[model samples]
Target: MTHAELHADAFATLSAWTPPSHGQFSLREAYLGFLAARPDATARSCAPGHLTASAVVMSADRRSVLLTLHPRVGRWLQLGGHCEDGDSSLAAAAFREATEESGIDGLVMDPAPLDLDVHPITCSLGIPTRHFDVRFLVTAPPGAVAVISDESDDLRFWPVDALPPGTDASVTTLVAAAVARG
Candidate 1:
């Protein structure tokens, strides 16, 4: 998909999504507004910020979650990254990132977004900017094994309730929601 196509998909996805909470509702509006104002909102080149696709990957048994220790942030985070030109939709981007990072195939994804988060960070552009993250739920097939990707410092499965120390609250929150609804 081209950048404009991705931007349109982002708007449609947020428009069709029914926020799971009031905060999500507000974030959804903000994302929609951003997309409306910026045709390049889906691209990483959008300096102010851009829409990112992310996933909370659940183990086959649904007891543990796969997490990546982000190399840049030095923190454990869910598997995800910027939407790519080939991505047809946000869910596809999320699934693609998860699969690429985990090296696990046959992963199932629910297209509905589970949560939204906006945070400032110096991304690939090497400048401070925010990520309007659209998080989703992805499930690994039985016996899936994760291989750490170059983008991550480490990769492993952690019990949902026993996540490693200093895990970001956003990650913890996403995992909790995924567990509750898994």
Candidate 2:
């Protein structure tokens, strides 16, 4: 699909959910606000009821991106988790998640959001949990090795076009955008 088509699809996927974790409005509301401000465009906004941050970390040379195999999700994904109260900003939260999940310290966190993806995750009770994911594009030093954390069973760097099987489509779109921006 084309870039615009990919983003439209991603937005549609996020807008279709009515996650219970969001006590107030649905993600569609937040996405609508973002859409209105940049009508005929897509931009970033704080998703309603989303409390997590994530990062798609790339090598300094821009050859590969770091990915982790989530234990529960069983899919290759960017590093992220629920935001803790201690985090001062979403960018900080994404930076923290990248470091913790990849064990790669001294990475530089970008100020602007790389992408915004809101989706529902079903909990053990089969109730829909929601996350308004704020994704950043972080840059790691060359030749950096990633150590897997407990949250992930495996960690690896893969070329942008050669992502692992069952990779999240949102992540793929974000990475493509990041690469294009460069």
Q: Which candidate number has the best lDDT?
A: 1
- Please name the candidate that would achieve the greatest TM-score relative to the true structure: 1
Give per-candidate clash totals.
Answer: 0, 0
- For candidate 2, give the lDDT: 0.70
lDDT of 2 by residue, 136-175 (tens): 7899987899998899978999999899877777888878
RMSD per model, one decimal: 0.8, 10.9
Alpha-carbon lDDT, every model = 0.93, 0.70
TM-score of each: 0.97, 0.72
lDDT of 1 at 166: 91
Which pairs of residues collide in model 2? none
Error of 2 at 120 (Å): 0.8
Question: On residues 1-182, what C-alpha lDDT tens digit does candidate 1 reach at each position?
Answer: 89898888889989999987888899899999999999999999999999999999999888999999988889999999999989999999999999999999899999999999999999999999999999999999999899888989999999988999998889988998898787
